[model samples]
Target chain A: MGRRSWVGAGLGAALVGAVGVGLLVAPAGASAAPPLPPVSPEDLVSSVMTAQRGPFAGEVEVDNALGLPAVPGVPQLADGTSTVRVWSGGEDRGRVAIPSPDGERTLVSDGTTRWAYDSRDRTATRAPAGDHGGPPEGQQQDPTAAATQAIATLRQTSTVAVDGTAEVAGRAVYQLVLTPQPTERTLLREVRVAVDAETRQPLQLTVLAQGQGEPALRVGFSEITYGPQDPSLFTFTPPPGTTVRDAPARDGEQRPEGDRPRSTVGDGWDTVVIGQAPQPGDGRPRDGQDGQDQRPEGAPDLSALGQPVSGPWGSGRVITTAVATVIVTDDGRIAAGAVPQQVLTEALAR
Target chain B: MTTVSASAPPASRASTRSVAPLGRLAAAEIRWVLRRPRTLVLLGLLALVPIALGVGIALTGGPGDGDGPGLVAAVAGNGLVLPIAALGLALSLLLPLTVATAAADALAGEAAHGTLRGLLLAPVGRVRLVVMKAAGVLTVAVLAVLVVAVVGVLTGLVVVGGPSGTMITLSGTTLGLGEALGRVALVAGWTIVQLLAIAAVALAVSAFTEHPLVVLAAVLGGLIVFGVLAAVPSLEWLQPLLLTSGWTAGADALRDPLPLDGLASSTGRALVYVVLGAAVTVWQMRRRDG
Candidate 1:
């Protein structure tokens, strides 16, 4: 009888343990008897993206105890771009350095291509059309594209439910709850978003972990604009004194038929397509160092070859030298192809 | 033959009486623990600190960026807080009192109550009784440590929210939040193990002294001596050998990508302290004359 009772107890304990595990592993939404309405991922993306385009403006307040001051009078550019200029109020309290007072980045996009320019770097880069890996370096994220991608990715990896309506940034929005799919890469098992019901723009977002814990991110926007923007705002031009280099072609050399110049000084000269003439301290062979060398009569000093460039490329000097050609794509994709220098010249000439 | 049989019954009765005293002794010891105000206080305080720290951190604008998992990584995440803050509130002030208070009464308090001789006369074996007492004390210490850990972590989470992965500033690399929390849990566990070593040391001190005050003084003195030795930079090589060296091993859990340096050595040292202290105490108790 005792043995039989022990077996019964063991079975009971096992049953309890199994139930507890199930309760933990079960999706939060699964407890409801009736199934809710299914949300279409594509529709959600379109709505969020559509609401993101605007001609609006407002101030954003950022509070960082690590010496980030509250930036007031921050301007939101007409093309949905935002800019804030901060100054050293008094002594440096160790906030991360902003390049300069004008060290602002403006993000502009026309439903399709997106571009971001850092006024301090004097460089602009664009996002690839239709690609989801996000924009290249120097380009700003299209808020609409980012919102769309975030929603799509979340939907693909989670069971989502509309958690009713709420107000965010003074706008009425729909609240969403997401439960994780078995193969999700995120640590969060659930997330909530306050999206504008009519426009589909996300007003606020929050991520919650599986276990009892605090929310990971709580971000709310100040103001959002929706409507058509000036078409010319999307176009970008290289600043004066800036060099525009053509992306290198695949084969690492210029095709003979291309209209680009072919220097007799080996492929290295071809690789030098659009940079400024060398300056003093550049570490290149000075005109007197190699008697065989000749150049245009008022050529800038070539001595500064090994010296760091003063532009954005300076930080990436090591990477540029190791690769055959460095091409900054139209959408700001920085790619290094094994193509020859002559091919880069030809591609740029076109 | 009738007389002999009658005498044998008395012998049997005496043996029964002897065994009865063992049960009474065990009951009395348990009651004493239950009545102890210090033990209750220590347990209560340990549990409260983590919650308090968590709330404090949260109200203070949350955990600082450097205070998060990533900073722990840059320093190799050994989990030991400098100055022994890793003990949370216990090491800060409560732990020394817990050790001293429990062990001080081990032998001396019995003598003070004039029950030392009665306890020695009991049928219960001396070595077994001492071992049991030590076990009870160790249990209390372990409980205190556990309370601190659960409370501290819960409070930290409430204050700072969930762990965000290690923030590698230079590389701008981040790990998953769950991984960071796991690291924090591991650090808390290591701290418990370190506290267990201190408990063993206190138990050993208790076995040698009959005065509770002397035991308390000895345990506290030993801790202070070791703490002083730890602060001497020139004796750095000996730091890892100290039982207290591994106290902050939990700090290792805060690293984004966990670092294992010094962990093995610290754990080994703590284990050695526990084993050696328990062994010596058992030997002494077994050989002690009633």
Candidate 2:
């Protein structure tokens, strides 16, 4: 065949594909998500859960639009885009750096010793392996971190669906949409995940909240490179003259620092974590629980702390602040979240 | 006479071929920028911010945690942070305004002073004027920031006298004195890059007007508008497009796993502005009566 005719056949196929895309591009104001394929919802979640995660390093754009007021910790969880760089050789050894206006904070796991360093604070903490929460030893989680965590955490609460094929980071992906079931009573409306077509690992996660027109949060790699990263990034030696604190604890034991906050309730997307408040009646932190409980001699008086409020759920007093809203129900249960006060009241009922 | 290939090997060859002409143009531009008293005064004012900060902190005992983001806050702990603080303050508005005024003045100042005819009257290509003027403004900016960094270090040492070897990074990783210094250079370079977008805007605005003050005010107004728009939550989607949004985000270089995404996007955003702005500036200048 002549070169022109040979090109004609290729051009014909591209024309057909272009027509198909014209049919597929949803009308403006519809949604960024395309219509769904015939795949089963159960299969979609399992496919995402089992996605292959090879050793890789890349930078991800974290755009948070949750509109939550700045909480005391995790202050940057608001309407803005920040950058996070992650390097993981499998899961046993990983490094993630999240930079703020001041400086960056890095959490590095070198197989045996896991280090968490806050450069702004000039403090480095080294703890034994499996000391605190992190990836299980050698689990493969390349980029679907939010997806994987979401799948496991929201499996019981969300109605999963296969939302069809789309492109993310310029690669073909299958969109898995998860909507929280009504009983979940979560502020979140829907979560759309883009899973890599080849590796099946999630490439991007978009979260939409109730009454919000835009994605509340999106965590995805704008750029990525797969392969082993430099081994030196996994190993860290605190710069000379740094204040190094070793947090060596045997398996299942808490760190030497006493009274670290813990959630009495289990963990999940809608999990209500009630930190151990000062002893209910005694007006002091529970210092006697551990020898290292270093509470100051005079704890702040908690009497008449919560302001009064009432609703269909019940009557309660809430301590409202810029960061968080805490509801101290007359029944003695405490609920808190970065969410609005109504969400917190609903959680109390749940 | 010919478009040059950007490949490393070919670029080197092309540079060697045009070295004499380009070198003379660059020398003339650099000399023009350096000889300006206003440029010297601008740099002098920037250098004084850190000294005033250091001395004030020294008088007040030291910085408190309540202090906002800057090297001044870090000065209490490590004098090395002075450069960081100085650069931080400059990156937001000061550096860009400085660069914008200088860049605007390059072409507009000449026109205002009635030197446009003399400059164009020479045997210089219009494109070469744009290139030379841009080069001149950038040199001044680079020198200005370097002064801020050096003066900051000197004043920090004199005032705080804290051990300056360690750098507190955002990612809990400690940067040695050497690496920290290297990062300061990277940050300063990135700030120049971010400022070029403003300069490009100034350059383009300068083309439309002959009065240097009008050009300066127009560029500064553009910056203020972008900052205000970025602050509005309703316009948050346009933040990435705003050169002002990520101007100082390059502070990420100090972090362990550098936020290449932020740094790259910030640079990429600035590049887009520079390309479009420079294009208009050149095109407009090429069409001018001079």
Candidate 3:
């Protein structure tokens, strides 16, 4: 009996120890980078631009360190890690589903018609494709779209390099780094794009601000699978009893009275977009269904945030985050960008 | 206890009883556990929570217009979310607490009553006794979760879904009646696994102490500590080892084209705890003498 008990005790101890060891080692193995052949930065950039985007589906995770306070009417760029699923069937067909605790917000486009549905409110908005606004602001979620846009805007004003080969979403990728030129006045230090080695598609985009150790923003695929997705995934019909609304034709023929026209000042990394905060219930497209955005009365008090400041641009508040800053003027003209206070003042002065 | 020894014809026959059939032992143990007054009361109380939640939302017009948790706020019009949300809320503490109570009673309560000595002296071997105790705890966990889920769905359908049983998914798609029930069942099954892991740990703790309250305190206290550790961002390296870290992953069932990463990882973590807890209980039982 003594020997049998001893054997039983030993086996139990061994099994528990094995679990601890396995947990520790599994992460280290998943993150270890595999060896790959070197490629030039120029060649990698060209390859990304020319690569054909075929059918594929994946889950993308966004990590935001922007430190922006929750403001009414402003899209809350997720404060922590949020996951969204993306599917692309080449050309104009695509779908992105953003699932929240209460319900999901899904945007689907099948080449010609686009549908935006919010399950929380049971509302669906249908619009013809090719609207100038694209998904309301801050809804362009696919990593490939974000990466390509960053390259197009910053390539001429920055130095590009291929730092090394790394793995993203379990796929080998070339790390393409873009650093703003010495003459450029911007808060951003560099942007890194991870391009899949075999497919030449961008799988992740990381943006870093000056002096910050952590990336200011990271939009990347957490898990991805290449090849054909269910064709039915890209189509949408509002479930019965949904309050369906047809989006008024926004063909640049007429601007709604509540629409606050926006204009940009300066160029490249320091550009500031200025626009008036639209009135409550102005029917300006809402990209999210957060509680803060649903207030039936007066706009979310912008006065509750940031320190008050007066400049030649006029008296207002300047709200700052890790990656961007916004100044809401007393007269309601708001200017925002990734530039410093001095640059914003200069742009406002102009 | 006296009848077992009285029935033994000879000393050699006692050796044969040591190898008790596992099925019979489990059946007897589960019956004993279910008959306990405390277990019945705890499960009955659990059934009331979802009904209260559903009625409150129906009368109050849904948690004061969405200031509440998303799932609770969504319960106004969508009846299917009621069961999932109730489980999610209960999973944090109440469900684990209920399972812990049964596990504590499995060995500690019996030992405190002096009945454990009779079972220990009986022909049942130490390993088989430990297995039977674990089975009793398992039965309690399964019944506690099913009672909550079943009551929640009935309350939800009656209060919110009404005659048009159609409900929307988090992905903005609608579900048929069959599909909605399937999702609720999936959530219930996943919750059972999590509760089982918690029960296994409570049983191990139960074996070490004669006072049932100590087992309850130790298991619940450890869970609270795991919650504190998981909240600290710098302690992320230690989060993976905590049993509470994956409790919220059960919400994955509510998603359309469900993402299994969180749910799968959480299940794997719970399985590890289950094995470790069972092993410790077996090892402790072998050393214990009547």
lDDT per prediction? 0.47, 0.69, 0.80
Instruction: Give the better candidate number (2 or 3) by TM-score.
Output: 3
Better of 1 and 3 by TM-score: 3
Ranked by TM-score, the better of candidates 1 and 2 is 2
Q: Across residues B1-290, which tens digit of lDDT does each residue of candidate 3 receive?
A: 68877886767776676577999999999999889898999999999889989999888878644356877876777787788889988898889899999988888988999999998898888889998988888888888889889998998899866327865676666677788888889889889988888988898898888999999899889988998898998887777777787776776777777777778777777877788788888877777764
Model 3's chain B yields a TM-score of 0.92
Each model's TM-score? 0.39, 0.68, 0.83
Best by TM-score: 3
lDDT of 2 by residue, B17-95 (tens): 6533866887888897878888888888888877887787778755554244534554565666667777888777778
- Each candidate's B-chain TM-score, in sequence, is 0.72, 0.87, 0.92
Candidate 3 achieves a global lDDT of 0.80
lDDT string, candidate 3, A1-350, tens digits: 68786686768667675865487337524576668789877567667766778889999989888887754322327477788899998878999988765567889898899998876666789998887456534234444465556556667778878888889999999998988887778889999999999999999999999899999999999888999988888888787656899977774334653355888997777888888865556655444434443576435544557888889879888888887888877787788998887787778778
Pull out the clashing pairs in model 3.
Answer: none
DockQ of each: 0.02, 0.19, 0.38
* Span of 10 residues, lowest total lDDT, candidate 2 chain B: B65-74
| Residue-level lDDT tens digits of model 1 in A1-350 | 34565455446544643554343334323222232344455456556654433343222322211111122223221112222222111111111111112123444444454444443333445554344344443126665567566666556656767766666555567677777666533334566877776667666767554442555345555444444433343434433322234323323332322433332221211223332333233333433343323444222222212323223332222122222344333222232332333344344444
lDDT of 1: 0.47
